[model samples]
Target: MANVKFDHITVRYGSHTVLQDFSLDVESGKIVCLVGPSGCGKTTLVRALLGLNKPETGVITVGERCLFDAKKHVNVPAEKRNIGIVFQDYAVWPHMTVLENVSYPLKKQRRPKEEIRERVMHALEQVHMTEYARHLPNQLSGGQQQRVAIARALVVDSDVLVMDEPITNLDAKLREEMLLEIRMIQKRLNATILYITHDQQSALQLCDKMAIMQQDGTLCQYGTDEEIILHPANRFTFEFIGVSNFIPLRQAGSGLALDCGELIPYTGEVPPQAENGGFDLGVRPNDIVFDPASPLKARVDSRVFLGSEYNYFLSLGQKQIRVQQSMLDARTRGVAKEGETVGISFLNTRFYPTQKGEQTP
Candidate 1:
């Protein structure tokens, strides 16, 4: 397995900067997911890693090999990188059989016929597609075709794997299945992986480390899912990764007081990089408690039952708040009709400043 690193990477299109001073290190055998909204340069980073996009100023290294170095003016071609890439649309040849598609990489490297067949069969078996070796791309289902793409990527035994929205086209159930399957295969092979996706749930579920980037090419945060969920770096980070209720706050003595007239105890300290105070309170939907007797009151605007839980959208004046609760009560879980008044309280919350760096209201 190989580790990947980018040193002060800067990518630009003409005069517009796409990525600025981006640096990251992915340890060997670890899976790192890059997630953010569209136009956040997620695809740009993927292209750069595969040597498809060259950075204006940076050094890219995979294991001991330097793929791109701006100072040395060295650029490695994508074909020679030996890195496996799985695209969102499974790029299998419609005319080729599964075996032929999987063995194409070996053929390109001019491996012996016997070795190519052995490796191709092994790769197909790993993805449970051995039975469909004779099937053509057009004959297989969407999920089956994706499996072929994965087999092709793995057949080369590349140390680094880059997947860009690999499950975007699959159904929800199939996506979940593929997620587990890919994770298991990666662990078994100990391959270093960089997964790029717009789905936050997939990123949170699969990544050992997660990175959230902004539309302006700034990295909002980088950490484990738990760390980012518990303590977000700034307002954008909190809002981008998951659902959050941003309650307005104002300075009250040493602490901050919410617009609902509740006082949050003072912490007496803030991030040194933050230039302001009492910006907003960020609380996840799951962290908020729903009770009929709490001091805070809100009207339920809408509700949706999601099998095992209920998601209630409440309106606190003009602010729309969301709360998700487990369906413990079969009868009462979906009983909250629209416009019903309900009380709410926060269990876990964090304060975020109004401005961080160049971010504004």
Candidate 2:
């Protein structure tokens, strides 16, 4: 496996810049996930890395080899880059059987027939698709077809594997199963993976490191899942990766006063350079603590059963907050009915300046 690097990369279409001065280093034998919203340049960045698109400026390198360098006028073709790509569509030939599909890449290299058959069979067994080796793509289920596609990519023994939302089409159960299988395969092969997906859960589960991008193709934040969750670099990154409850507040004497017209204690110092006007207090749903004896009160607006937990929507006068708890005690957990008053406290909270009347913090 080889390390991949992007240095001051820029990609544009007409006058619109899709990616701007983006740079990232992906270490060898590690899984890195690229995550963002629908219009974000996640896909564009992956395409560029795969050598499908050339950047207008900057350079891309896989180990010591320069894949793209504008000043040097060097551009490596996609097929010559030796990178494997698993697209969301599976990209399997309908008429080809599983074995033939997996062996196609070996055929391109003109390997011996026996060697090709051995590699293809081993790859199929790796993905547990050996039982259906002779089955056509049309005869396999979506999950089986996806396995065949993975086996095809694996058979070539490419060092770098790029998968773009490969499991997005599967059902919840199948998606989980596929994720486990993929993780096992990657561990066994020690392959370098660059995964692109909008699903936060998938990224959190699979990626060793992750980068969050904006619609303009700019890198917002790149870090471990824990770092991004606990210490978000910006307001946008905070809301996108996890659930956040925004409580409007204004600076008071030494603390901050809730827009609910109540004063709440703060444990940390708010920056003096903070913008004027209202500020927002961010609290995760799981961080909200409920106590029957506390003074701060809220009424239960709604509650929903979520299998392992119960989601509660609590209303404090005109403001609404969400809280989640284990599904152990139906009496205590479910006791808070609609309009029932109860005390509330936050386990942790973050502060940020309000933006455009929205509590992005």
Candidate 3:
């Protein structure tokens, strides 16, 4: 398997710049997810990788082959790049049967019919779509059609697989099933996959490495799932990747004070980019506990009893926050009713710069 590299890539349309000086590397045989808000250039970057959207500057390489380089004036055609892409819409032709769809690429390359049949069937087996090889696209379910799409992409035997919102069309349960199936197939083939999605949960669960892009077309942060989750680089990262509470802060002696007048002891590693010697306290809902002795108080506004836990929406002053508690805890200590008061304490927290959009102090 070959690694994909983007070096100082930039793309623009007329006066609007889509990506600026973006550089990232997807390691060989690794799953990397590119996630961000809508219109953050994730799709544009993918298109550039596939040679569909040519960058105005910089270079792109898959494995050892340089596909695009502004200095060298080299731009390879998309078809010649040998990159397989599974699009969000499945892109399956309505008139074609599964076997025909899977073998279309090979047929276009003038691959021998016997070899095409062997590879197409093997690809179908990988996606568990062998039984539906003769079925037309309209005859299959959404998930089955998606499997056929995957089979088509795999039949090319590309080292790098690019998936663009491959599961958005499926129901929640079906999405989960496809996620697992895709992960398994990827591992079995050891294909380096670059998956793009607006779904943070799927990105977190599926990718070994995660990259977050901002609305301004800049890569905000990129690292392993654990690194990004536990140590977000900025306020945007904290708020975007997962559910987070942003508590306003004030200077308090050597440490910072919360809006609710709770003293947070100073730590050496204050987050970069906070203003006025202030930082925003960042904590996940699950880390916010119900502490009777805690000074912070909030009114429960709503409660959602998920199968394994209860998510409580609480109002602290005018700001709202969510807290999750295990069902076992709820049974042992009855959950606070809506409109009831509860004490709040943070089990863990991260500090972000008080100012939004600032990457560093």
Candidate 4:
């Protein structure tokens, strides 16, 4: 319903700076997941948008409305911003019934009782919680309580919504259910949502676009899940978004080599740029394949059948790398026993500078 933008935003806490020149755009009527490691300023960004934390410098906007512009000296009050937020705790009043909780916002605005009832039921129906409107928070299941919180946000008729780790407290099964519920509700409402979380799995499943922030509070990369997974902007994006194995690289003779114990020659085509040292070969677990003819070898430390796939822990010199095989692949290639020596090769391999804090090639 509205596009949210943070332009050149910088937030500081006393002597320490939390974010510097941070910028992000959430397209109208789309769910953008802002994901990062803990304490990466995801919540701080949320606070700034909600008018709870004032940024040291920047402009915050909802569609055409200028919420905050430091140079312009315009900062809208939190309640007047008309932005809905579903907090992590669900924060439903324990004493209030579901109907009461959903209608609280409208009641605060002092809408007519008839109009409040009409809108309250409509919001409850949107979340499929109309049947339990009279039930107290304790009487409803975790998912139901979460629905109540969402309905409360919707009751305000805010076009943009911010969901801050809304499903983290639920069990895995319920988390999945709530995620689906949220997605369906978002689509039905055509709501512009900024979903914040540290769980990459959920972020991958729920987001139309994903934004990855590093530990230092800088946004590393932002794109669709496929773009971030298959074409990472740098080493940090590759290592953070998915399971990654990084092996130090060295210049071996005429060709590049992987330092997996012995200097196993890498026959894969290398970019002309990697002729020098200080690069690490990065590969995903699924990309590591078993090739009997390949010269690279690793000892199988263990094999686990995890229902859908077989996981292999392999020792390539002193370091270990994990390989995942589909059930069909396992049947076709046959399972390798523990302590068995097998030839391995990397597919879709990437090279990154091994220096810490260095993101790019």
Candidate 5:
């Protein structure tokens, strides 16, 4: 296994910069996911690591070997990098049988026929595609073709695996199944994985570490799933990773007052360095509770049935807040009828200073 490192990397096109001074490290044998919105340079990072794009500055290293260094003028070819990559499109050879596709990498090494066949069959079995080994990619379902692609990547025995939105094309159930399969394979192989996706749910479920990027290619935040969820660095990090309700607030005396005619006790001290200006309160949908006894009240604006739970959109004065409750709570407590009034309480509240329409640290 290899630890991948990006040191002060920058990429530019013409005069416009894409990624600027980006640095991150992927620890060996750990799955790290890079997630962000479209045009955020997630793909650009992957391309640079894969030797498809060259950075205008800085260095990239895998383990102790320097892969790219602008100062040293060293550039390693993709084929010599010894890394396995699985694309979102399931880049399988349509004309090749499943077994043949899995064995393609082995053929490049001039391995003996018996050993190659053994490795190919083992890889197919690992991905549960042994039954379809004789079938071509055209004959298999999307999920099966993806499994073949995984098998091909695994059969090479590479130390690091890079997957680029591999499950985006699958149906919900199939996507879940593939996620489990990929996790199992990674565990079994102890492979260091760098997965790139825009889906926060997938990143939460699959990666041990995650980094969020911006449109300008700067990294907004990088940490474990829990850290990113509970302690978002800014508004963009909060909104990008999950659903959050932002309520306007202002400083009043020693405490903060909601702009909407309500005042909740502030448990933490707002930073003294924070500009004496507008602020916003952030709470996730799951962090808001429906309490009938609470003084703060809201009218039910809409409701959505979400299988095991119900999501309610409530109007608190002019502000809208979303609350999630168990299906049983919805049924027993009686669903919040449209225009019906209900009390609201914050389960976990946080305050941030807003500067020029952006949340500041």
Candidate 6:
């Protein structure tokens, strides 16, 4: 396994610069997910590292090899880079059996038949797909097909494996199973993986560290899920990582008030920076609790029971915010009807400094 480096990388198309001065270091033998929205240059970065796209300025290195260096005028071919990529669609051939698919890379290199068989079976075993070696791609489940795609990437024993939205086609249940499967495979091989996706939930479950990118191709924050979620670097990181509710705040006499159509007195402690004015109070859905004795009132617009939790949409004055309650909490406290007016209070909230006159969304 190798540590992948993207040092001061920038990629452009025609006159437009899609990626600008992006730098990230994927530690050796660890899974790092590059998560962001669509058109955020996530795949562009991957392509540049894979030698498929030339970076305008930067250095790309894996292990001891320098695959690309813009100043040195060095550009390795895609095949010689020794980096494996599992695409969004898996890209397995329907006409080929699992063993044939896994062995194709070696066959292209014209490796010894005996060597191909050994490596192919070993890769299949790593993904727990050895039993279905003879099965065609069409005969396998979506998860099983993904395993074949991963096994093919492993046959060459690349230093880094790139999974780009690899399980987006799977159903919710299958997606969870595949995430666990990918984690197990990574552990068994101690593989250096760069998983790219727009899905934060999956990234939270699979990454050793996560790199968040903004829509304008800027790297927002890079850290463990806990670090990013609990201590967000900025408002973008806070809103992007989880379910967030933002309420506009303004100065009301000696204290603060929520600008939710009506001026509701904020009994919560105000952070020092937000004391002067114009800040958005960002709260996670789970942090908002119902309080019968509280003056902060909101009308419940809808209630949904999601097996393990309850999701409620509440309208506060003219603003709407989401609230989630665990099954135990719902049963202990009580559930709210669609038209019921309830008092809600925030627990852990973050203050986001905004432009002085910025209106609420």
Q: Which candidate wins on TM-score?
A: 4
Each prediction's RMSD over C-alphas, in Å, is 4.2, 3.1, 3.7, 2.4, 3.6, 2.0
Give candidate 5 misplaced runs (Cα > 4 Å).
Answer: 109-112, 250-277, 326-335, 355-361
Per-residue lDDT tens digits for candidate 4, residues 145-248, read: 99999999989989699999998999999999999999999999999999999999999989899999999999999999999999999888899898998887
Model-by-model lDDT, in order?
0.83, 0.83, 0.87, 0.90, 0.84, 0.92
Question: What is the per-residue lDDT of model 3 for residues 1-361, given as tens digits with 9 covering 90 to 100?
Answer: 7999999999998899999999999999899999999988988999999999889999999999999999999999999998889999657998999999999999999999999999999999999998998899899988899989999999998868999999898999899989999899988998899999989999988998998999998888999999898888887888998888877766667565556434433333345554345667788998887877777778999999999999999988766888999877788867888999988777787776567663232
Worst 10 residues of 4 by lDDT: 352-361
CA deviation > 4 Å runs, candidate 2: 251-256, 260-277, 327-335, 357-361
The predicted structure with the larger lDDT, 2 or 6, is 6
lDDT of 2 by residue, 1-361 (tens): 8888999999887888889999998888888898999977877888898888888999998878888998999998887888888899757899899888999989998999999999999999999999999999899988888898889888887868889999899898889888888888888888888889999999988888888987678889999999999989987788989888887776667655566545554434345644343777788888876777666788898988888887899876567788887766555644467777887777777778777856423
lDDT score, residue 275, model 5?
29
TM-score of each: 0.87, 0.90, 0.90, 0.95, 0.88, 0.94
Q: Mind sharing the TM-score for model 1? A: 0.87
Q: State the weakest 10-residue window (summed lDDT) of model 6.
A: 352-361
Q: What is the number of residue pairs that collide in model 2? A: 0
Q: Which ten residues in a row have the lowest lDDT in candidate 1?
A: 266-275
* Candidate 5 residue-wise lDDT, 141-189, digit = tens: 8889999999888887776889999889989888988888888988887
Where is model 3 poorest over a 10-residue stretch in terms of lDDT? Answer: 260-269
lDDT score for candidate 2 against the true structure: 0.83
Q: Which candidate, 3 or 5, has the higher lDDT? A: 3
Q: Give the TM-score of candidate 6.
A: 0.94
Give the Å error, residue 296, model 2.
Answer: 2.9
